[model samples]
Target: MARSSTPFSLHRLAVALVSCGLGLHAAAQSANPSDSPPSSTALPGVVVKGASEAPLSVGGFGDTPIAKLPLQASIVSAERMTDRGLISLAGLTSLDASVGDSYNSAGYVSYLKVRGFDLDNRFNYRRDGLPINAEAAISLSNKGSLEVLKGTSGIQAGTSAPGGLVNLVVKRPTLELTSVTLAVSERGTIDTAMDWSRRFSDGHGNDKAFGLRVNVEAAKLRPELRDADGNRWLLSAAGDWRVSRDTLVEAEVELSRQSQPSQPGFSLLGSTLPDAKSIDPRINLNNQSWSQPVVFEGKTASLRVTHQLNADWKLQAHGAIQRLVNDDRLAYPFGCTASDGTYYASSYCPDGTFDQYDFRSENEHRDTDALDLSAQGKLDIGGMRHDLSTGVLFSRFRSRLQGQAYNFAGTGNIWGTLPTVADPSLTGTNTDRTERSTEFYLRDAVQLSERWQGWLGLRHTRLHRESWQVNAAPGAEQPTRYSQSLTTPWLGASYAIDPQLMAYGSWGEGVQSDVAPNRAEYVNKGRALPALRSKQWEFGLKSGSRSVDWSINYFDIRQAAARDVDAGGGLVERVLDGTQHHRGIEAQADLKWTGGGVVASAMKLRARIEGSSDASLNGLKPANVPETTLKLQAHQNAFLTGLELQAGLVYEGKRMVLPDNSVAIPGWTRLDLGAKYEQNVGRQLLIWRVGVDNVTDRRAWRESPYQYGHAYLYPLANRTWRASVEWVL
Candidate 1:
C-alpha cells in the first residue's frame, strides 16, 4: 500500500480554518442585514419546478428550456439533494427510475447504470459538461445540480455509453452569500460544509466584472461493518472574469481524498444459489486481520472561455485534466458450492474447507484529459429561424494496475467469526492500458412553423486503444493496438398541439469501444474488439400547466451483443454476433399546490414509473435489470408556519440473476421520510432537517449479475437516520 504524502492533521487544520472564516462572515453579515442578498425559500438540494420551466444546458447546446427540446431529460437540484441526504451517485437511484447501482458497494468503488447499460467511469462520467473519471467517490458539496439526458447523445458527447449521459453543473459565485451546514447521521457520522462567494468590480464600480466562489467539506463515519472507519475531505474553487462586454473566462479546481477499509460483496456459491433472505446483511467477509484499507486521492482542473462574436454567433472553448489513485486490498470469495453447501474446486478455497479464504491486493493509478471547442449561432434562412452548433472533442485515458494474491489456509465459514491471518506477500505489477478518442460533430435545430420544429445532427468519431502486460511470458506477442472510426446521425421532430402540450419523436445512434475481458479464463485477453454501435427510436408527449407537469415516453434500442465462449484448455473468448434489443415505456409527473386552504399552504408531489423488456432472446430478461420500477415522493408545508413534511417510496420488480434466465432475484421496496424547519432570527436564516431511510428496516440485495455468469450480490444498508442544521447570512 502507498503511504500518505500529506498527514491527516493538515486536512483537519484546513477544515477548521474554513469553518472559522464562515462563522466570522456570517456574524458580519448579520450585523449589516442591508448588505445581504435576497434569500431563497426553496428546499435545499431539491427541484421544485418542472423541467419545461427551468433553464438548462442540454448536451452542450447552450441554455435552452426543456419545452423546446425533443428528448427525455431530468434535473435534480441541490435543494432536492439536501432534502434526501443524497451525497453520491448511488443515492440517485432512489429518485430516478432510469438509473440504478451497477457493481457498487459501500466503502468501495462506485459505478452506475442507466437504462440497463453500464455508465463506465472512463467514458460516461462528466463534470461541468466535461468528461471525468468517476470510479472513485464524487463530492457533491460544490455542485449546483445533476442533469441527465436520456437515450443516444453521441452527437453531443462523442464516444460514450449508449444508455445516456449525466452532467454535474458546478455552482457559480453568488454576489453576496455565506452559508454553513453541520450534519450528523447514524453510525456516529459527522459532516460539515461551508460555501462562500464574492463579486468584484473595476475601479468604476461596474458590475459583471469578476467573481469567485469557494466550497469546502469534511466528513467522518464508521462503516456498517465492524472495525472499519471512513473519512473524506474536499475543497473546490471557481473564478470567472469578464474580460470585456462580449467575452468571459472561467476556471475551476477541485481536490479530494477518501479512505476506507475494504468491504467485498458476496458472489454466488457455485450453481446452488443461496436465498438472499437467509444471509446476514451486515456480515463482513473480508475482515481478516491482515486486510488493508482502500484509499483514493484525486485532483481536477478546468478552464473555459466564451466569446460572443456577434448577436448571431458565439464561440466557446473548454479543457480539463484529472488524476486519481486507488490503493485497495480485499479478500474476495468465489466458486460454487454443491447442493449440500460443500464447496467445489475454486481459487478462493481449493480444498473447499470452511477454514480457508483467498485474498488479493491491487494498487492502481488513472489519468484523464479532455478538450472541447464549439461554435453556436442563430441563422435566418428564407424567413425560417435555425440554431446551429459545431464542435470538436478529444479525450485520453490511461490506467495501471499492480496485483498480488495469497491464500489463508485456515480462516472461517461463510457465516462464522473470522480468524486472524498473516499478510499477503507482494506481487509485481501486472497490467497497463491506454485509450484515446477524437470526434467532430454538427447539429441544427430549425423552426418550420410556430408549432413545428425539426432537428438534425451528425458526429464522426475515431477511437484508439492499446494494452500490455508487464510480466509477459517469453515469446509473448507485442502490445495490442486497435483503431477505428465511424459516423453516427441523429434526427428529431417536435410539434406543439397547444400552448401547453408538445409531441416529439427522435431517432439517434451511439457507439462504444470494446476491450477484451481481463479475466484469466479469456484466451484472447487484452485484444480490443470493434466498436459496438447502438440505435434508438423514441416518441414522447409532454404537458405543462401551472400546477402540474407530466411526460410519457416510449423507446426502442438495439445494440451489438458480445458473449463469452468457452474454448479448450480452460480458456474463454468473447465474440460478438446477434444483437440485443431493449424496449420500454416511462412516465413522470410533478405537481405543486399553493393556496389558502388548510391542506394547500405549500405541497409538492413527484412520481415516476417504467416498464422495460428485453426482446433479443425470446423475451428473456437481462441480468440486473428489473422489468418494472416505480417511485413516488411528496412534501407538504401546511402543518406549521416553519415546518415541512416529506416522504417517498421506491419499488423495483423482479430481476434476472443470470443471462440465461435460469435464476431470478426477488423484487424489493423501501420507504423514506424526512422533515425540515426554517426560521429567521436577527437577519440570519436557519434551517434544520431530519430524515430516515428504509423506515421499515428492510434487508435486501441492492444489485447483482455484473458479469456474464457471476451473480455477485450487493446488499443494501439497514435503516439509517440523518439530521442537519444550516445557517445562511
Candidate 2:
C-alpha cells in the first residue's frame, strides 16, 4: 500500500463536524430577534450575471465557450439542484436524454451507460478535472456544480468510454453564511444537513485573504423495498488562501459512510420477458434473516494552485486522491438451480421456484491518485492568433480483494414462503489489480478569421497493468502483466452565422483496454485482450438567445466490440468481434418567460453490429440501450403569492434484452410533479419543498442487462413523496 503524503483521519473529521454543527446551531438560536435584519427569498437556478464567456472545464477547450466549442455540454448549478430536488446521480441523470441506467438496483451503487456504452466507473468520473474513483457512494452536499461533456472527450480525459466525461467541482467559500435543512419522505426516512462558511480579509486589497467552508450531514435511509434500510453520515471541509494578487491555493477533504443492503433485480423465466405490472418493487426475494447491510466508506482530498504568469498566460498544478471500501453480504438470488444440481439459464423456475445463496464479498479496497501540471496562454504565431493549452497528467489505480462466497442455501417459491438460509463459510479467492497511465496533451485554438475558428489537439499515453493472485503457492503461475502506448487526435471547426447562431463540426478517436471477466464459462477467462479503438464524428448547430436557447447535433460513433463465445460443448471464450456502429441525433432546447422556464432534451439512436467474427452476430442490436429517449422539465411561478409548480416527463422506447432480439422489454413512460413555497417568519427566511416521483405509479421494467450469459431485469421505483424544510441565518 502507498503511504499518503498528507495525513487524514476520519476521527478528526467527525469531531470537527460535530463541533461546528453544534456551535452554529446554538448561534442561530441565540440571535436576538430585535437585532435581526429583514429576510427575503430568491428563486433557485435563476441568477443575473454579466456577459462573460466561461470555458467548459470538462472539454479542455481553454478560453473557448460552449457556443464556440464543437460539442454540446451541460452545466447544472447548485441552485438548480435545490429547485429540482435532485440528490443522487439517479435523479440528476434523468434530466438528460443521452444517459440511461445499466444494471442499476435499489440499494447498490448505480451504473450508467452513455451513448450506448457503459461508462467505466474507474476512468469516466473526475473531481476538478482530476481522476477519482466513483465506485463508492459519492456525496453531493459539498459540490458547487456538476459539468457533463456530452460527446467524445479524448482531448481532456484519456482512455475513457465515448460516453463523455463527468466532473464534480468542489464548493468554495462564499460570503458569511449559515443554513440548515431537515427532510422526510413517505418511507419514514429522515435527513438533516448543515452548511457554514466565512471569508476573512487581513487587508483591504490582496494583502492577505482566506476562506473556509464546512458541510455536515446525517440520514436514516429507508427505501420502498422491504427490509432493506440503512444510515449515512458525511463530513467535508474546503479552504482557500489568496497568497497574492496573481496566485491562489485551494484544498478540500471529505469523508462519507453508508450502510444499505443491496436489492436483487428480477430476471426472466428462461428467455421469457415477465409482465412488469405483476412484479412488485417492494418484494424482498433476497431478504434472509442472516443477511446484513452492505457498507461503503470513502475518503477523498484534493489540492490545487493557480498562478498568473502574465496578462494572457496562466499556470496550474492539481492533485487528488481517493480511498474506498465496500463490504457486501446478502442472500443473493441468481440463476435457477436444477434438480440435478446444475445451474440453468432461467432466472426463476417455470413454477416460480428459485434457489438462494449466501453471496458475500468483503474486504475490498480501491485507491486512486491523479496529478496534473498544465499551462494555458494566448500568443501570436506568424500572422494568426492562437490559444494554447498543454498539460501532463499521471493517474494510478489499485484494488485488492480478500475473498467471496457464493454457496447455495435452499430453494424457495417466489409467491410462497421463502426458505431459511445459513452461512456456509466458504473459502475466498484473493486477488489484486493495478493500473497506471501517464499522458501528455496539447491543444490549440486558431483564429482563421473573425467569423471562423479552428481547433486541433493530440494526446499520447502509456499505460501498464498487472493482476496478481495474492495467495499463490510458491513457483505458481506468473502474474499477468500488460503494457500499451497510443496517440489520440481531435479536430474541430466552427462558423459563426450570427451573434446568436453558430455551426460546428468535430472528429476524434480514442482507445480502451479490455479484460475478460474471471468466470467459470470462459476457457481463457481472467486474461487481458488487445486494446480496442473507437472514433466519432459530430456536426451541430446552436442558438444562443435571451428568450430561447437550443441546439441540435448529429453524431456517428464506431467502436471495437467483444463478447463471450461458445468454444465447444460447455466451455466459452471471450473473442474480439468486429465493430459496433451507432448513429444518433440529439437536441436540447430551453425556453424562458416572465416567471417560468422549460428545459427539454431528446435523443434518437440506432445501434447495430457491423462486422463480427460470427456470421450470425451481424446486424443485431446491442442489448439494454433505448432507441428513443425524451425528457422534459418545467417550472412556473403560480398565481399564489409564494408557491411554484414543477413537472417532469420521461419516455423511453423498447429495448432488446438479448442480442438476437428474441425478447424485448416493453417501452415505458413516467411522470413527476413537485411544488415549492417560500415565506418569511419574523426575521428568518424559511422555504419548503415537496415532490412526488413516478406520480402515475407506473410498474415498468426500467432496464434489462445480460451478464454471465444470464438475463436480469430491474424495475422502476414505486410512487414516492418527499418534503424538505430549509432555514437560512
Candidate 3:
C-alpha cells in the first residue's frame, strides 16, 4: 500500500503544478499592468541582517512588527540555526526557555511542551501558515525560519492547544546561490545538503515572470543511545509566478523519509521514585534482539494565489495536502517495587523477577487537507483608520491505527540482574478515526486615538469526528460519531508611548476537541467529551531599536482539566470538572553591535528568563516544568579575518516529578561553544564550522513524568562535537 501511494501523490503534484502554470500564463497575457490596481497585501517587510530584527506574519491579519504587536513572539532564523547546529525541534527547547521537550527520543516521534501545557501535533503545527499534522520527525533543511507565538492563539489558528502555535516559513527563490554543506558529528553521523535558487525571465528581460528554489538533504547517524541508528532523506521544491502585475501564484512540495532502531527511555519503578542522581545516563534496559526499528514517510504539497481587486482590497487563497505513514515496533517494561525496596514486574516476588515484559507494535497512517480563503484591506470609518480581515478555513483529517501487544513470560529486576525474553506474537488490532472542521473569522485593528490601537476578532468553528472499532459481541455498545461547535473571541489594545516603546494588553480564548481512548478498561470508552476551553489575559511592554530589542510580559491562563472517574467493578469514565491555571512572567533582550568601541567588529547577545507557577495548585510548580528557566547566548567576531566565536548557556531550575508533589528533580546547567570561519577564494567561498555541546560532560536528567502515575526520566546527552564545511561554486 505504501509503495503505491508514493507514485499517486507525485502524479497529483505534477497535475496541480501544470494546471496552475497554464492558468497563470493565460492571465498574464490578457491582463495589462497599467490597468491593475495597487497591491494591498499586508506582508511584513524583510530584514536580512538577523531574525531578531525582522517582522513576522501574524496569521490571517497579515504581518506586523514584533514590538508593535500586542503579543509575545520569537523567531529563529536559518543563520542562527546553522551557527548553533540546531537540526531538530529538540534542539530548540534548549535555546528557548519558553519551550521544553515532552516525550522526545531518537527513533521516535517528537512532542513539545509550552507554558506547562502540551502542544498537540494535530492542531498546533504549521508550514507556510497552513496547518500540517506533524506526528513524525520534521526536517528543517528547507525552512527559512521558525516562528513561535506564545499564549492562546485561537484567533490565528481556529482550534489549537493553548500552549502556543509554531510556524515553519519555507525558503523562497533568491538571486544568489549558496554553498553545499558536508557535516559530521562525534556520534558517527554524516550529513550532506545542497541548496540552489534561480529566477527566470522572458526574452525581453522581465525578471518577475518566474522563480524556482530546490533543496535536498540526506543524513545517517548513530544515536547516543547504545545500539540505535537512524537515517533521514528530504527533498523540497518551491516555485512562484507573476500571473500579472497585481496577481501572484506560488506552489511547494516536500518529501521526507526516516528510519531508526528503537531505544526507549527509562520509567520509574512503580510508585517509588528513584533518586535521579544515582542513575547512569547511558543505560539501556530493553532486549536488543526484541526491539524493532521505526520508519516514517511523509509528503506535503501546497498552492497559494493572491490578487488585488482594488487599491484598498486584496484577496488570497491557499490549499495544502499532507500524508504520513508510521510503522513502529517496541519492547516495553512495566514494573513496581514492594515496601522493602524489592522489585517486581507483575507482582511482588521474593526472587525480584520482572512480572511483565511486553512487546508492542503499531502501524498508523494519516491524511490531511486544508484550505483557506481570505480578504484583507484598509478602511476609514468615523475618521479612524482600521485594518480589516475576514477569512474561511476548512480542514479534514483521517487516521487509521493498527496495533498489537504480547505479554512475555520472563521478568527482570530494576536494581539486580536483567533477563532477556523472547519475542511474542501479536494480540489484537483495531480502529479508524476521522476529524473535520470548518471555521469563519473576522478581525479588525482600529486606531482609536493617536497613541491607542484596539483589536477585535472572533471565530466560529464547527467540528465533526467519527471512529469505529470491531466489537467482540453483537450487543456491545459503541460510539461512532461526535460533533461540536464553538465561538472564540479576541480583544486587545496597544498604546504607543513613543516611537520606540509600546504598552499592550489582551484577552483571548482557545478551544480544542477531545479524543477518546480506545481501551477496554473504561466503561465509557470511546465516548467523546465536550470541547475543552482555555482563557488567557496578558499585559506587556516592548521596546526596540536598531541595536537593541527588549520585552517583558505577564500572563495568566486557566484551562479545564480532563481526568478519569472510577465508575465501579474495574471500570472508569472520563470527565472534565477541575481547573488548571498557569501564571508567569517572561523577559527577553537582544543586542547587536557592528564596529563598536569596547567590543569586536561584530558582536551579538541574546538572553531570556522566565518564572512560572501553577496557580490552581497553591502556586506549586507543575510536574516536569521548572519554575525558573534561563537561556543566554553570545557571538563575536575574532581578531582573525572571517573568524567568529559563539557560546551559550542553559539553566533549568528544580521541578516536581509527580502531581502530588512528592518528589522533585534537581536543577542542572549546560554550556556550549562553537566557531566558524569563511574565506573567499576567487569566485568561490569556502566556510568551516565546528561546535561542541555539553562542554563539561555533565550528566543530568532532562525530563521527568510525561505520563500520569509513571515517572519517566530522560537523560541529557553527553559532550558531543560537530564539524561541517561548505563550498560555493
TM-scores of the models, in the order given: 0.86, 0.90, 0.86
The stretch of ten residues in a row with the least summed lDDT in candidate 2 is: 3-12
Q: So what's the TM-score on candidate 3?
A: 0.86
lDDT tens digits, residues 1-729, model 1? 443423223334334533443343344334533455656863444344555677657565566677667887778899888988987877778887877777776677667767777777777778888888887878888989998777777786667777788888899887888999999987788999999999998666677588999999999977456546789999999999988889999999999988877556665554455666776776776676666677888898999999999999999999999988877666655454444666543212322224344555456789999999989999999888989998888999898766555455354545636575655655333667898888898989889999999989999988788877654465452467888898989999999876667779999999877777665788877677776788998877766544455666667778777767668888888877556666666666665556210100110111111122223343455677776677777888857898888888888776766666676778898899998899888899999999998899887877775463346676667788999999998
Q: Which tens-of-lDDT digit does each residue in 227-255 have in candidate 2?
A: 87888899999999988889999999999
Error of 2 at 360 (Å): 1.5
Which portions of model 3 show Cα errors greater than 4 Å?
1-53, 270-278, 336-362, 412-419, 422-424, 470-477, 595-621
How accurate locally, in lDDT, is each candidate? Answer: 0.73, 0.79, 0.74
Ranking by lDDT: 2, 3, 1
Off by over 4 Å in 2: 1-54, 203-208, 339-343, 413-416, 424-426, 471-478, 517-527, 566-572
Could you tell which candidate, 1 or 2, scores higher by lDDT?
A: 2
Better of 1 and 3 by lDDT: 3
- Give the Å shift of residue 162 in candidate 2: 1.7
lDDT of 1 at 201: 85
Task: Find the candidate with the highest TM-score and give its number.
Answer: 2
Which residue pairs of candidate 3 clash? 345-355, 346-355, 354-411, 354-412
